[model samples]
Target: MTSPLHTTRRAFTWMLGTALVGGASACGLSGTGGRGVIFRMGLRTAKAPGEESPGEFTTDTGWRIRLSSGVMVLGPIYIFENASPLEPTASAPRVLQRLGQWLLPTAHAHDGHFFSGGTVLGEWDREVVFDLLEEAGEVRELGRSPGIAGLARSFSLLLQPPSRALGAEGAALGGRSMILEGTASRQETHVPFRMALDFPPPVELQRVDFVPIAAELDEGGRFVVEVQPHRWFDGAHFDRVTVPEGGGVVDLTPDTQVYRALTLNVRRYTAFAGTWEPA
Candidate 1:
């Protein structure tokens, strides 16, 4: 006859071995071969529809503006598996469905929220500085990164200053995230303006999040981000700009109305769009 304690110890050992084997099998099935896709990424700027010239457009306030130079620092892009609630698919029914899921006892047990920021499918955490005027009709490749195969529903990126390693591009920014040199004219008034924008203290990362995009990310895919610089001046009141005496280019300070408008418009979702292409 066997002792009861010895038999119980043996049973415990067998159960532990079975659990370890099951865990290993699950890991092998989900981890080893799931994230094998590689994606290339690029950035560029383009003229919005109805604009005949690359850097010249008429603002809504009747100011004909021509940008002589434009540069911006953008990076640390992240692609997510879930779409934003503002997207077309997020209707009244979808909200109710998510509410039902949230009501479940097991729903709150998961990591992340019920509505926003789903699993990260891919990321490029490098800061890149690109010339908006130079990339107007061309695409500049911003290195590749590994990604998992999934439906990329939305993406986000940071609009911080360029790294010092970016050399001249970084220096041109002068610790600012964006700089634009342009001249705006309305009737008899012409004002040449230089706008330098930077996010100051307490505002570390100027993240533009949840820009809706749909992409079936698979092998050899390329993600392209298109920026519309003209749209940045949509609500700008150029008439409010103080013209310097003797006709020098006016430097737009943070207090100016036009500068404030540009700052807000630059971060708007309509100013940027994303698309995926085959590599």
Candidate 2:
């Protein structure tokens, strides 16, 4: 058997590689550009100590995400008071493994559609799911090729049009609040396949206004939306935003995983624009 010290060393090395393969920068990923729209968002997740059926578990936690935006891309630079198991054991790595995947590269939205990176260990158990901005094509699924980095590397190969064309159709904006209504007809493994995240009841998506916000236009005419959370997970949260310019950004704050789930969308909005920091 490997010594504990050796095991720790291996874990550390593995984690480092994991961070590289799954981190935000690995894929030349960056925030979008625009007149940044910032928001203070509240989020909650559920978890439990005992095991459920195979490949499942329960957990519970919540957080508030402070998000900044560019026209199209959002990058979550911080996270706070999230929750997840510290290590993986024989029974399963359910929570930790899933958290690993999320923090790794589970979902990324671009142009209007969403692409998911499902496996980091090559072909051991890798998959990718796509969500389109329209309502025509069926959900496309691609099996990963052999290799630990195949899924991440072969990302471009799995391409399909969004079932519906993404448009400004019902998208509307107000003073500090805005709403864009769209549908994802296919079942996505974006959140729940590996874990269950629970939020408060009366969960519904609606228009919300983030006050005290501002927008700073850059030389490229891109805006970097910034905000400070009124409240957040350990005072932080993960946020996704659509940049007026075109793409979107996933504003990641320093966070820990408490649980996981599907059918829940956490969001944030800001009133004033400035460089964001811990408040």
Candidate 3:
């Protein structure tokens, strides 16, 4: 089978910048003795011009919205060491399977962790489930694996709902993958809205890629997989939705107008703008 495609990126920046860490030939597939690499990752909101942070913004529809609780389950971040293999005959890099994979496959998201693949040097496990909104504003730790060897040409991220694998015991997230509880207001009308996004494994498989741009991971480099929250509501139409009387709560269940908008919103926003690393 053909290997995953590779992309080239000259430079990436927003409020943050993706710098060129570990030089081109810094390190590749090291053995027992060598300067190991620290793999860091996190989720951050896009920096709005006037705003200091990403959340707490208004939509184009004139409806003011804010995230009351933005709890989410994300995981299985695979960093492809040699994504673009020079040759097919080259032996696959070794995978140092960690013990129990961050608590084991049976672990929960609360105290347990669902670690995916192990490291290349047959050392520690590299993947884990993270509460993206749990530790907002701060760069939460992702696990560390020695030997930041080779070029991390590309990486794939798998974000799912609260599961035994995700280590989050469905935070009141009954029958849904993503639970978005917030309030929307228009003029003098303030309505509470609860949007439950159903992520049936298949939809949870979206990837953030910078193709045609050679985005490589460097040693001692810190990378964050940021998700722009506001981007999720891009091109969404709220004026067309019909809110229930009295309650004024817009329940965005599946198949509803607002529901469809939420679905498309995620699809459009769930992508990497580019790689950026602050000095």
C-alpha RMSD of candidate 2: 22.1
Residue-level lDDT of model 2, residues 48-145, one tens digit each, is: 22422111221123321211211111121111111112223477758775464335422232332212222222211111121111211222222212
- lDDT per residue, candidate 3, 173-276, as tens digits? 56455667677667876767778776454422332321111334445555665655665665556666677876756787776676777665553313333242
Q: How many residue pairs clash in each candidate?
A: 0, 73, 20
Off by over 4 Å in 3: 1-36, 79-136, 145-155, 168-172, 203-216, 269-279
Tell me model 3's lDDT, rounded to 2 decimals.
0.44
Best by TM-score: 1
Worst 10 residues of 2 by lDDT: 150-159
Cα error, residue 172 of model 3, in Å, equals: 4.3
Per-prediction CA RMSD (Å) = 12.8, 22.1, 13.7
Instruction: Name the regions of candidate 1 deviating beyond 4 angstroms.
Output: 1-35, 87-115, 201-205
TM-score order, best first, reads 1, 3, 2
Model 1, residue 226: what's the lDDT? 80
Task: Give Cα distance to truth, residue 125, candidate 3, Å.
Answer: 7.7
